[model samples]
Target: MLDEIVASRDAAGAALTAEVDAVIEAANAMSDRFRAGGRLLAFGRGEAAADAAHVAVEFTHPVIVGKRALPALCLGGEPALLGMWGRPQDIAVGICPATGDLAAARSLGLLTVALTANEEFPEADHVLCARSADPLVAREIHITVYHLLWELVHVFQEAE
Candidate 1:
């Protein structure tokens, strides 16, 4: 059982590794958006909604001292709320989004990012897929990816 778990994670990690360049590129774009006064608005349904809240807190209240507390909000999977608050410079991150949310965000000119496994969100400007079939494994990979994004965004911001 443990071996299966380890192998699954290894495979997922390898898949993400192959996309490291894309991740870095996305992070750089995120940094640029932040520099332009953009905020991150994350939304998801059910369990993913909790993850979205965590993502918001991570950005708005960093665990590391001296890390910039960027503006981030959890939309509780409410695309209507996004319509109310989204701006052209804002970022819309959909963690396993329902149909049309990412589309709506893109229609409003927000940079769309999708964190998902298996499900395809074509509207997202950046799609960070977990490469795992298991829901738990996918969730773990999403957490790692978001953390990397948070760290890399700061790295790029500081470089400026």
Candidate 2:
């Protein structure tokens, strides 16, 4: 089982590397949107939501020595709001409404970035698109995505 897990990880890593250019490009686009006075919003369910929140906090408060604060928000942070929304999918849409919501309207200038393990959600301007092979693999991909996002944000910030 351990060997199989290691082999799976190795395969995932190889596949991920093959798609690095596309990932970097997507990250760059996201960074551009964010630099233009747009907020990077992350949303997911359960553990994925926790991962989203973790990434959001990292951007809001960079641990890196010289990195500056970048605007990032997680839609699942408020338990009351989540409870009202009922599901992660609903919250994703609610947070970045197509129209109607005053807060969403106010945040129109901000770029809405969505991170989800669920590919069904249509609100995501940029989707991380997690591989559904194994739980551990999914987690690792999320971590990679966050790290890439951070690097991209820094690049965008520096170019300003």
Q: Write the per-residue lDDT of candidate 1 for residues 48-150, one digit (tens) a residue.
A: 9998999899999999988999999999868668888999999998887776778877998998888888546678899899989988989998898899999
Best model per TM-score: 1
Give each model's whole-structure lDDT: 0.88, 0.56
RMSD of each: 1.3, 6.5
- Score every model by TM-score: 0.95, 0.70
Worst ten-residue run, lDDT, model 1? 115-124
Query: Once model 2 is optimally superposed onto the true structure by TM-score, how far is the C-alpha of residue 86 displaced, in angstroms?
Result: 19
